[model samples]
Target: MVQSASIQLENPQEWDLSDLYQSFDDPRLMQDLEALQQTAANFRDNYRGKVKDLSAEQVLDCLQQLEAISQQAGFLYAFPALIFAADTRNAEAKQMQDKVMEAVTGIENQLLFFDLELKSLDDQKFAELESASVLQPYQHYLYNIAKFRPYKLSEEVEQTRNQDSLTGRQAFINLRSLHLGEQEYDPVTTPDGKTCSTEAELSALLFHPDRDVRYEAYQSVRKVMQQHNSLYAYILNTVAQDHKLENQMRGYESTLQKQLLADEVSEPVFRAIMDGTKSRFDLWQRYYTLKGKALGQKIRTCDVYAPWGNDPVPPLSYQQGVDTLLAALSQFDVNYARRAEEFFLKNWVDAKVRPGKRGGAFCWYAHGKHSYLLLSYTEDYNSLFTLAHEMGHGLHFAWIGDRQSYFNSNPPMVLAEIASTFNELLLLDYLLKQAEDNPQLKQALITRQLEDQLNLLFRQSTVSRLELAIHDRVTQGSFDQSFVNEQWQSLYQDLCGEAVEVLPEHQVDWARIGHIYFKPFYCYQYTASNIVSLACYQKYREVGKDFIPGYMELLAAGGSLDQVKALRQYVDVDLENPATIAAALKYVEGLLDQLQATL
Candidate 1:
């Protein structure tokens, strides 16, 4: 629970997992798990070696069965996974999560032959399968599987890898999570000598108006990371080595290519984001300089996230925040607002700040159902934005669930952040409109908007660059903590220039980025998605009401359509063109102009 005076909500919301399961002891949960295992076994026995020879109708039948198994397995996985996320220290939840994971992996291993056999089919046979009208509903899914034909290993080898991951690559990932959840941090003291502990409480101080409090809170985080630097370095290196060996085994040319293939994104599009953002480092440095000028002092790296002026954005209770979000969404589309409200009314969000809870917010969805949003809300401006961001994800998948099947509900990584970030933009637009008469409030809102773009566009690109460097360096030779620290410092130096002082503790920051340890190449999508959303928002501004229908259509398309084609079809955005990035940056420059005028 948030014991800090900073808490504004009298009673924060907690999610009801009963939607998935009444309790861990639910007999239905065990029955479903056993049935899922048996179904997967039957599937393997029936079709393991016959996928290539199956007729179109037979293939469609197998696909429907496969989809059912996936949906059931996903449901089972969600219950314990969400439970563990809400409370990592729950022994029963962690055990159940592990058990479910092991079962799911075994099941996946059994089904591996289906895809491997399909991939191994001769081109003529595959083409014949594709030409079947019966398979039209899964055309994109089949096509996606075909895209990885060149990289897949033999069935036996694939299953071996899958089974080994329980103790291999995945165990280290779990270690990082469990370790972070179990450890306690040093108490951060305020100017009045008040002490704050919990990660959420300490993190909230980053936005404190007092610079020393921000610095102390920042140091409190960094000191812990520094102490655990060696352990994190080992985990990172081991995961990198695992990926490297897998790439070699599977014949992937590079790590980046392996990740991009899943997103259906080409190397050129990724390079465009990397080069496009790095080229605009000047804009990043300029904003910090402007921030320093406004604050009457040169800012430190810790001050980068500090409140902009003497008057930070006023705190709102949980209800007030939700109401404001509902109003903003209602203005865009009544259906969207209604969908956003469901999460709150249904107790689908976990907003309480408690020990053993994970540090940031995330929206998790079960197919044919709703999304569960987890965040430790401290009732600050950032928490309000966090609520909006996660709600964006919730609303997005709700639309997806209504329009697509389980397998097709998850959008590609590059397109995943679109709805979430767009929600933040809507919230900002609403806040700005409401603050039109108050200059101080207007400045705070505009500054928040500008700084958000800077973080998503510039800071994320730097993180991606560091990821590339880490992988590239690992391929050359083994590295230690100093190597990773140097890579982080050098990258920030290039991005921040001399505008802000890069503190020594900041060098160990790489160890704290969960994405680097868990999901490789994930940070870049933040930059990529922000670029796409900004362009979409710009179009909305020009076309007004007409844009809502197309935007809704884009969300409803889900993963059934090729993301690139879906964007072009629903909205006129062409991500293939490098000029798209330039247009987005031009919009950022317009934001800078707004800030300058406001100042």
Candidate 2:
């Protein structure tokens, strides 16, 4: 008889597209598109001049109907964009995405007057409509719209701005994505003699045990980025300047002012986090000093991710990894375990490392039906943590999809990572306990956890500061390539101190972070999320099994509440307090002590 070892676990259930549509060619898609167009046209025809004249109930019903239609259109357009990004070479998928974007753009253009019209209503009428039960669920969003009433432009100007946005500054950013964002790397031979060059491959090299390999990978990456620096710098400068112009027009006090307002967070809270992290820069320096001694090098930025010692890569079978995650999750609650198992069993994840698939992992939930996970799994220890992290995001999406409408499906980025990072913290704690008897594994786990904190806290904080400096300079009409490079060096020096040498070639690092180009002032969320997760992790340790249900409920709340409200409700931490961030740094300090003991 054949050995049972010869059998392998089959891949999990692939995404069920029926809920989206039976297929791309399914008639429902076309019907939905046509219905969306008709709805927009009908809404404009019926409500353009009649909203103020209608009763509160009628106004609320009209807004709900419009939102429902818009939500359907959003799913129709976004699902294809995600599908295309995962497999860009698919001609049909690409065409479908393009068609949907065009149709949605047209629909949006037709409905551009809705917000302005609503804002034009008298205060008493607006209050009555807002208080209507039908619209009460969307009060937060509506109130946010009303908050902008003070700055509302004339209908003609607003329409012009909306139209120009598509072809003006926005088009430049879109062009950058199509042109400058495509980076190709030269292949480097690994120790095993296999050559690899993709971004994912080079990223993995950063974790390689061989110092020479890690250094070479870093050099290659810097070289590639340097080659594109001129173009990248132009894109960066233009995007920042564009933001400056828009913010000035919108009467924002500063570039970051609007972002703070949207997050329902104050600038001082942001300043406190930044100032608090900077004051503890020595923590990062200490980490790098320990890392350099372990790697036996006078550390450089290139050696930052080099492995500490000669240890063979531990191989993890896919099933074993899944089992590990499930077991670790079981500590939380049965629901958490069941949800994770569903991801493995229901085909919700794309785990193969295929050619041209996007690098990095993400959980995409286009509709309430399911969430899709993208990963190039390598079966290493970090890969296991990555799977757990992305699955955490998936579980959050699954829970929120069941509880919220599509319009309210996504929480702010501030609250978004609470679930994902909480999952990572749980997994790390589980692993640490399991390895208590295995000294080498335990040391490695602690080291890895510390590295993650460095990335999420120190590195992200540095990036946030750089973003603020660049935007400030742009607002002052003085931002350029030299300014950005100087800011990068200054921030790096401040964070890393004398522990590592910042190479001249690393100056263009800002250009490589896609977030700067796509999202302004967004890296702060990583810092915020990490610290929030750290506090939540501690709470879990204190409360044990009692904490899981409340955590799940937080995920299920989605965008219904702002970050501050959701976090306070579940984790009982206040973003306004310095103690929250301080507590997380203390945890990192404790981990460092543990690692030093092992050394």
Best by TM-score: 1
- Candidate 2 pairs with clashing backbones: 13-346, 13-347, 14-347
**Which 10 residues in a row give candidate 1 its minimum summed lDDT?**
1-10
lDDT by residue for model 2 (552-588), tens: 7888888877678778988787887889989989988
Give the poorly placed runs of model 1, Cα more than 4 Å off. Answer: 1-10, 191-194
Please provide, for model 1 over 40-159, each residue's C-alpha lDDT reduced to its tens digit, 9 standing for 90 to 100: 999888887778779999998988888889988888999999999999999999999999999999999989888889999999999888888998878888898889999889888999
- Clashes in model 1: which pairs? none
lDDT of 2 at 332: 74
Model 2 weakest lDDT span, ten residues long: 1-10
